[model samples]
Target: MRGGEKCLEVFCEIFPEADLFTLLHVPGSVSPVIEGRRVVTSFLQRFPGVERRYRHLLPLMPAAVRLLGLGGYDFILSSSHCVAKAARGGPGAYHLCYCYTPMRYAWSAYEAYFGGDRLRGAARWVVPPVMKALRRWDAGTSAGVGEFIAISHTVAGRIRSCYGREAEVIYPPVDTDLYHPAGEPGDYYLLVSAFAPYKRVDLAAEAFTRLGRPLKVAGTGQDFERVRALGGPNVEFLGWQDDAALARLYAGCRAFVFPGEEDFGITPLEAQACGRPVIAYGAGGALETVVGLNPEEVTFPAGFQPPAGEEPTGLFFTRPDAEGLAQAVLRFEAEEAKFRPEAARRQALRFGRERFKEQARRRFVEGFERHQEKTAARRTGDR
Candidate 1:
């Protein structure tokens, strides 16, 4: 019920289920968009101070999922970033989990979650034991799910590593059609991100200040004050923006600077759909989504910094550092023409909403049908 809420917003639209199951909810805490829908929380409902230390509530998750009757549903889809993937399903039921990443707090960013950062430090002092207990619960509960749909190949790799389970990569959806190319380039580079430690917006601010390029950042989070404090003359931080405003920014921007090494960056695709070229860390969905221009032909590399002349659909920083990002931004402006509106549009087409829906439908139906066939064969043999 945090950043994973964004992915849940997309999945709920696609599948359109009747009842939504979750661990907890703070009314009006999440966006009003999900109101009126029946959200069934786990047994930890109204537990004293649970919302504040909710990550600690992980131990209760298995018990909560077990409380959900798998036998009662025709299809059980879990929009998970964590153990929501671990929800059990009966033999005939189909459990489709849209995984964000295999538990960031445990696998990848363990130190960061418990590191000397203010929040982590506070968590350590207050809820270290609970966090430890939940991690153990999370590992055990992961074995319950029937199938996993990863949001990115990076996440699919994590799924393999943590659960010893394979997952199909389904790039998260963006409203491409809604974010058409503005056709008029603005004077500034743009950033649309929540101020999280992992996002590394500090690098962007530093680079823009050094290079003397105007940068406008949109979105807000816990790190907002720190991020703003780091900003120099050329950087402007706009707290948060609506879709219309964000689309306008995407449309008119010279380029979209995405500093984070995201699992799958919806923002970059959104920028490309608006015919603005992306400057992203070369990793995760950027590998599959953005085509690097090389002289020989267009090729998609697995991580950042593709071979030159690859159509410049987007420029990738060699790594996630200020200097690398600055150089990439400079290179993007120098070779910006190669990233034509038509080419950006063409690349964005691969991640269109319709394509994603069709793929999901095919996979879900195919998997469910196969399960049915296997069940039928087993029953017939027994008879």
Candidate 2:
């Protein structure tokens, strides 16, 4: 499951009877914990082939999400990467949002999502103005949220920058119990992520191609064809695998490659939980999760070395491109023995599912109490 869905799973467990509101709903797309709930979809769900072509409706999403009309709910807990945070609550209702990021496509990831070659013809001319409007709408909707719980410090910073609001950071969970060390690692490297443009799967494929090392990618998305075309003989595509299959791949890979800069990447932690090291780009949540040699730490002439008693679980490439990643793979090969499986697994435990649940519960209680206090004060003033 994706990071947002994983968080939603916990929310569903905590509030089993709560109704789920969204812009669209594709049955069987998410876990039973979520799908089993009374999911209320907006007008966007009525659009023809909305499940597959939702990205084409990005410009209309703000209106569609706002149209969800969540005013009657006593408490609304929105798990938002995009417009879900914009859901309107009743005057007395508390809207607490667990924000993944401040709409990446509308903010920092604009080029990655709608850059040259991706957009075409009339669409290219239309998207810029639409994105500008989306950004304004995104910022405007932040006022409706009573409190914001960010998925990571990286995202908290973005929330502050984008919406002028502070948020508490709670790193997303990884199923360490399920993804624990199992079989011996295979010779190949693994990259498990959607083939989205921002995910930079193409960078990983090109890096492995240059290294002549086997790189197995698991998952598919909008950029699947583009990424698949870029892969050389050494790169293998294993489109969307089941949990068992994913766990097997995680346990068997020599090291996991995370080329993208995520708000908070759960996959890297999942790989670490499986006792496999990671080779990631030195940016975003990877900076916090991956305890390894960074580019800045790599001094010329003498090069970099881990201090005594220090245990690294992965390595980071300074650049987020093919050549940079290829160099990192070579570096990992050199000091591969230093990255102990036990150490990697230990690091993974720090962000366990139990930890997330506990933190989220505490935050929710605090937010609810604050909302109650505000409502009481307002009632007293009116009298």
Candidate 3:
């Protein structure tokens, strides 16, 4: 399930009457309660190939969303990964979009998403109309929403750039307290990620193969076979793991290798909560999370060169290449003690679920009350 679904659950718990709306739904795929709620969709939800060609379908979303959202509801909280933020609002309703990023297709990762990499060429040829329409609608409906709740500072920047809107950053919640320290490191390295093209799981597999280190990959996606084909010696692919198994892996791994440049990676925080150090790419949210090895305070392992300007949380490799990632892992093994369990715990606390809930509740409630007052004033004036 997408992170948006989890956010929606929170929204539902807090506001039971709040209905769930989206572009599409795969029946029997999501919770019945969520599915049973008042249903609405963008017309693209009915398009034959819309799911397969989502990037192209994105442009259709604003029109489709507005079809359901226009002048409806008292409050709209969209757990958006796409143009759900474009949902229109009624007079008194507060549209609070929990934005993942300002739609990656039109912005920062546009080329990576549509630049003939894989389906980009076919999609480009096939869905020009939909893509164009979605872009226009995306821009138009963005003006409809009242407030935005960005999942991360990284995404907040994208939101501002793409929508010319200000957003409050509220990092997504992770159940860190439920995960425990295993107290022993397993011989294997761990990687858990949705197998999206941008995730770069190939890098982790390649690096593991090169280093001849034991690696266990957990998760499923279109790139599953491609990633498995690279597996050799010590690399193992274990389809999708449940929460228990995943938590155990986090607690057991020598280190968690997160190669992707995510908006805000929850897995890294999960691993840190488990008291394992992470080996992450230097850019994106990892820049804020992972700290690097220090030659002064700790021993530098051979074949590991520290990146310039790295802190002490975990090691950061600038390049996404297998060699660079492998070298960082090797170095982390050498200077593992420098990144203490307490330090890892401290980093996880920075994105604690309690903190996220507290911040979001305060911000949303304040915004909602302000909207409530404005609505009262408008009614009085009308009278």
Candidate 4:
């Protein structure tokens, strides 16, 4: 399961009685915990093989979301990156949205998703207007939600910018129980990521190629062939990995390399959970997660960069390029001994699975009660 599904698993444990809603759900494709729930898929689920071809059906998502039978539901919690937050609930329902991002394709990732100048035929013409409309609708739907919980402060900023709403940051959890420190660390640096355009796996491939250092990449996607082409003999692709295989890779690697500016990077935390250090681009979620080694080299916030005595858990590259990454790797190598594995383990523990469950449940219960109070007060005034 990906980070989103992993989060959903926690929700399933939290509210076992609540019905699951989604645009599509391929049975047995997710965790057993999620599968056991009473899943209510949208109209898109009626079409065969929609799971594989869902991204191609983005134009239909808004319509599909609206058609979902959300009536009579008193509490709705939408785990949303896209159209799920727009789910209109029954009257007096309190909807809390755990937003991963404010629709990246319509905003920050438009260029990456659309791939300007690479488009051909009708898609070149048809896709643009649909995204424009999506942006308007995406922003408009924020009013329906009673509260917003961001996966990271980085995402909280995006929520403020896109939806003009403030959000409380609740960082996503890492399964530290499954990913613990074990065995001797290996010589090669590691990266376990989807080979997508935004992931910038090519940047890692190119950096390792320049440094003539070993790098192991895991996972595959639409941009796999393109990223693979950029990698030299020094870089190796391990393809998709199961949980056991990924935990092994995390524990064994010298360091995990994160090339992209993610909204909230869960994989880096997973690496840290395994008592492994990370080398990441010094932006977005990395800023919040990584306790940087070379504070002067990277622009950290008021605390991390200034506090010279803190045991650094990772290194950060200011420039988002091959050369910058190569240099960060070199810096990590020079002072790698100073970074204690235990410190990384402790840092990862701060965002453990149980912590997330506690916070989410508390927020939902408290907010639901307040919403009921306001609803009752309004009805009294109406009378």
TM-scores of all predicted structures: 0.84, 0.95, 0.85, 0.96
| Residue 155 lDDT in candidate 1 | 79
TM-score-based ranking: 4, 2, 3, 1
Ranking by lDDT: 4, 2, 3, 1
Candidate 1 collision pairs:
282-304, 292-310, 293-309, 293-310, 293-311, 294-309, 294-310
Cα-based lDDT for every prediction: 0.74, 0.87, 0.74, 0.88
Compose the digit string of candidate 1's lDDT tens values, residues 1-383. Answer: 24356556655566665677777777776655565578777778778888667756665666776776566676777777666766766666666677887766666666545566545445556556766666677667666666788887777877777777888777766677778887688889999998877787888988898899999999987678988988887899988888889889999999888887677778888888898888887766566667655323323422234334445577666556899888888788788777887778777877777777777778777877876787789899999
- Regions of candidate 3 where Cα sits further than 4 Å from its true position: 27-59, 116-133, 291-311, 375-383
Q: Model 4 clash pairs?
A: none
Better candidate number, 1 or 2, judged by TM-score? 2
Model 4: worst 10 consecutive residues (lDDT sum): 299-308
Clashes of each: 7, 1, 5, 0
Models, CA RMSD each: 4.0, 3.7, 5.5, 1.9
Per-residue lDDT of 1-383 in model 4, one digit per residue for the tens?
98988888998888889998899988888999999888888888887788678888888999999889999798999999999999988988899999999998898778877876657899888888988999999999999999999888778888888988989878788999999999999999999998767888989999999999999999989889988999999999999999999999999999999999888889999999999999999887887887788666665433223344667889888888899889889988999998899999988998899999999889888888999999999999999
Q: How close is candidate 2 to the true structure, as a TM-score?
A: 0.95
Cα misplacement distance, residue 44 of candidate 2 (Å): 1.4
TM-score of predicted structure 3: 0.85
lDDT leader: 4
Off by over 4 Å in 1: 1-17, 26-36, 43-71, 90-93, 116-136, 294-310
